[model samples]
Target chain A: GGIITQTPKFLIGQEGQKLTLKCQQNFNHDTMYWYRQDSGKGLRLIYYSITENDLQKGDLSEGYDASREKKSSFSLTVTSAQKNEMAVFLCASSMDNTGQLYFGEGSKLTVL
Target chain B: SQWGEENLQALSIQEGEDVTMNCSYKTYTTVVQWYRQKSGKGPALIILIRSNEREKRSGRLRATLDTSSQSSSLSITGTLATDTAVYFCATDSNTGYQNFYFGKGTSLTVIP
Candidate 1:
């Protein structure tokens, strides 16, 4: 079975600081996505890439930037962290836009 | 409750009881997927039902969809303490690009 791995399971940042999270999937899926999950809230899409170097913005993409450096890797950057902002960032990959997705454990971010 | 209308819901039940969770969407979707997320983890797809199919079953989990009502329900029979988690319903919509949207989720606590 393939696994999706996310780096730095825990992250801490200050207000207005920039933070980056990385993800890698060995499933060789064509579509990759980044989602943010707040406490007791649903997963909101931040960005998605259908192929290498392709980026699509989702409803909550205002303060984030994403990069699909390759088919196996996708990264998300928080332009400016907000104080007291705590959330989990998830990385997922699917065979296509309309298929089952495999997700990583997640990267928890704490902004102080 | 409705994903497009309100916040997440919470449900508590005994371990051996049967429980059901409901979700409603506002837009047109080709598929509705049910995902389970444990504490400190990303969501994982448990059951999925397409728009054309009214019901789908997998092991102890069952999912039903109603296109006319834009709603879906997920039922788990004879639940166990391990089943305690947040359950989310996700929908795939085509808006120039295919995007998957997730509901706020139902936090289920299976008390043993």
Candidate 2:
């Protein structure tokens, strides 16, 4: 069995500060995704990488950037943290675009 | 925008009772996936139904899809308190480059 690990389970940032979340999957999946989850709002896709060095924007990608430096590692960056913002950032990987996804526990972000 | 509207926003039921959640999408999809998210964890795929298949079952969970109506339903029998979580329905709508679009989700609380 493979696992998806996300770093810094809890993160605190100041308003306007930039934050980065890292993810690594041992499943060797070809597609990786970053999603922001807010309570009662469901999960919103921020960015996804179909392969190494490939990036695709989702509906909620305006304030975020993503990088896929290697097949097993994908990272997301928050351009500017919003004051009092709190949400969970999830990292998920799929074997392909049409397969099941395996997700990390998540990285909780709190902006003060 | 391709996401479906879930039937119930939230539900509370006894541990041993049966429960069902419904969702209806607005666009054509090749597949629909049901995901469950427990508190402090990322969502996990529980069941998936394809356009050609009308029904699929796994253990105590059953999923039904109606392509003509663009709707799907998930049923769980003899629920346990551990089943309490938020359920989301996702569709492979092929919207943009992103493959899956998810609904707001149905929050279920199984009272033990």
Regions of candidate 2 where Cα sits further than 4 Å from its true position: B96-98
lDDT string, candidate 1, B1-101, tens digits: 22322248899999899999988898877888899999877888999899999999999999999999999999999999999999999887666324788
What level of docking quality does candidate 1 show?
medium
Clash pairs, candidate 1, are none
What is the C-alpha local distance difference test score of each model? 0.88, 0.88
True contacts kept of each: 0.78, 0.60
Q: Write the per-residue lDDT of candidate 2 for residues B15-111, one digit (tens) a residue.
A: 9999999999998888889999998888999999888999999999999999999999999999999999999998875654245778889999999
Q: CA lDDT of A62 in candidate 2?
A: 89
Name the candidate that leads on DockQ.
1
TM-score of candidate 1 versus the correct structure, residues matched by position: 0.95
Which residue segments of model 1 deviate by more than 4 Å? B1-7
The superposed Cα distance between candidate 2 and the true structure at residue B48, in angstroms, equals 0.5
